[model samples]
Target: MTSPTPQAPVRRPTAADGFVVVDKPQGWTSHDVVGRLRRLAGTRKVGHAGTLDPMATGVLVLGIGKATRLLTYVVGADKDYDATVRLGVATTTDDAEGQVLSVAGPGAVEGVDRPALDAAVADLTGDIQQVPTSVSAIKVDGKRAYALARAGESVELRARPVTVSRFEVLAVRQVTATVADGGPDVPVVDIDVRVTVSSGTYVRALARDLGAALGTGGHLTALRRTRVGGYDLAGARTLDELEKQADADGTLATLPMAEAARATFPVRELDEDEVRALGYGQWVAPSGRPEVVAAISPSGELVALLEDTRRRGDDLARPVLVLAAH
Candidate 1:
């Protein structure tokens, strides 16, 4: 009897080069989603625009394949969230995942009514200095702040400027809540808010600040990011949905790189010569817009991200990132 020949391993088709807005589930870190996407896309070239806390759930913009190059620009876009700020209990991590630090007495929360809450929200709105939660990704002397905090080291982060464009209180409720591991109840006020903030703003910090302004310590109990720049929950797909698509057709649906760039940036339609110039690492005429512009080829392909630069007394646009080769 002749020995049977072994068959080669089957390879799945790679996913298209584009962006995917994932409806990130709670308790999954942004990196966790990327790890899963790498398998689904059959490519390791996956990146995310911003990091979402493991406890947070909502719109997480992911870039796959060539679209990963565009996430640098996407990270600067504003974000929106619906969050619940619990006033009366302070936590070590400034969220429900942390240990209870302090619980406010009943009298403290009762003083924070609608008008007072509104005033506090207004104070936090617009441009303000905010101290981020100690347990954050911020680096302290080349070490992550959260790592230091977890190691029982004191982490005092400096306040930074952040813009809270919209901070509307949707509802307020007074209820008894458990503040400790054991089931002892305390009176607390929970304020639901819809917040639109600049790229670097931290909603958990906002929750903490609101409580401090109201004379009650506070922490974030719930956080759901509804939007990240042009990407929103309406267009997001769950991990299971993506897996189903991949399993059915060996690929996941994604917004093409050109479409993603056009939607997120100012466009500069390039002529043949300009397209050739960018592809060859040369400069072209300035688009006159100060912001980064999406340089598009005549065939509607995204060529590069162009920025105006003055060289030899003439203003010209240079390729910050060349996406498509001519």
Candidate 2:
């Protein structure tokens, strides 16, 4: 009898090194999403670009493996949101997840007309100082603001400048609804808005300010992020889809590092010598522009993210982050 030949072992897929845009579901905190992705990507190196409230949903950009280093750049990108601001009621957290703090008088919400609402929203637009929501992740004296707020401690946060580039009212509806569990039905004006704001601008605060301007207590009823910088929901995938893909393939797909960088920053192609210099941690000739750029090698790999770090007489293209292995 002849001996049977041994078979080669099948290789399972591993973690990909790039970005993954997740369509975050409501009730999952940004950290929760990160934890879930850590499992799906089969790597604990996952990180998110921005924090999203647990009650809010939509575009949440996550980076896996070596791509985690790129998240710092993405964190400062502008964001777009679609939200429903409920007038005639206010909450402790400035959103539906908080306890009901106050309710407006009868007919208060109905009294707000289109012109008045538009004027109120306009006041919130442009450069303005805003106090972040009390229940926020902001650190105060080494403690998170939300932790103190939840512990019955008063948190006084300083007002910071933020820009609201677009505050468009998409729809307005008057309805009777409960803003909290086991709460009395209240008449409220729900204004659906699409807002584009600079990074760090709080949409919850916008709703609160808008309500205060209209003489009706207000809070965010619902919020969904639609875009983050050049990335949008168009490229986002649900967690369910990711799980199935990971289960079948043992890995999830991701936006390539070079492609993501090109979509975000100006491209600067490097020659063989320059690429070699970057690999050796040496500065190269400046790219003339002061802004950061994605430096690509001849073979189309993202060699490094460079910035013009030269002073008056000195010339150098400094590597902000080197993406390629040496």
Candidate 3:
């Protein structure tokens, strides 16, 4: 008789509320990270603010316990990426992982110099209409676009407005490349770039458009996200690091929900009287800052997320989400 495999010990749930900034490894899906974290954090409430593609690697923000409620606002924040776009080849998925669609003729990609590349980059900067890559996670009629595309369905997505606040070329390299469509090796120009764009902007789509505009088909070869809203690589920890930390003492360095709120939104410290009224769901006077503001107690606890709105004719800062009990 064979001995059964040793089962791992399951840690008890702690239900601690906070966020974990993970330096997501390549090949691990966003859900894959969350599933692993569910085990490490000793809770099933682990959730991420944004989904990073398996090919992309960098900072991925995760929320624990009640922190999941704050992820919606985080999803709307701007993003930054460091990507390499190879001008000379196009791919079915607009990235290196996809099969090549076409290859540029010899000397075609080389003809695109610094000035030409800059002009193309300029054209992509600022607010522009962008069609998300077909393999993206966008949903069509409730089915994920990627899911449909993977199943051999033709996907035609529409263009939408997105702001590319900054698009700067960091370096350029000239070399020969192989085509994924089984074509002969061709000369290619690889342009390394960094972009800061509004939420929902597709960097892969930008690579496709950049190549199309230059008349020398292109696709993303590498992508690494450096920043997401207020959270950046500087604050991130690797999954291995987190796992070791968890094993050492069943603990993690989580950003408390109040600190996370303050990091993402401006604060409005409330007095004792306002705190009492807010506990009952009553509206308080406006705190000057527009949009969603974090309402904190003088003692530094985040009480709720508040928004100023007009009720009848009077303006009041109503509680959008109450975080604390009386």
TM-score of 1: 0.95
Poorest stretch of ten by lDDT in candidate 3: 177-186
**Against the hidden true structure, what lDDT does model 3 obtain?**
0.90
TM-score of each: 0.95, 0.93, 0.95
Clashing residue pairs found in predicted model 1: none
Q: List per-prediction Cα lDDT, in the order shown.
A: 0.91, 0.91, 0.90
Query: How many clashing pairs in candidate 1?
Result: 0
- Write one digit per residue (lDDT tens) for candidate 3, span 6-75: 9988675574788989999999999999998888777889899889989999989999988889999999
Q: Which regions of candidate 1 deviate over 4 angstroms? A: 1-11
lDDT for each residue of candidate 1 in 47-76, tens digit (9 for 90 to 100)? 999999999999999999999989988899
Per-residue lDDT over 127-222 for candidate 2, one digit per residue giving the tens place of the 0 to 100 score? 999999999889999999999999999999999999999999999998898766796787899999999999999999999999999999899989
For candidate 3, the per-residue lDDT at 221 reads 92
Better of 1 and 2 by TM-score: 1
State the weakest 10-residue window (summed lDDT) of model 1.
7-16
Pairs in clash, predicted candidate 3: none
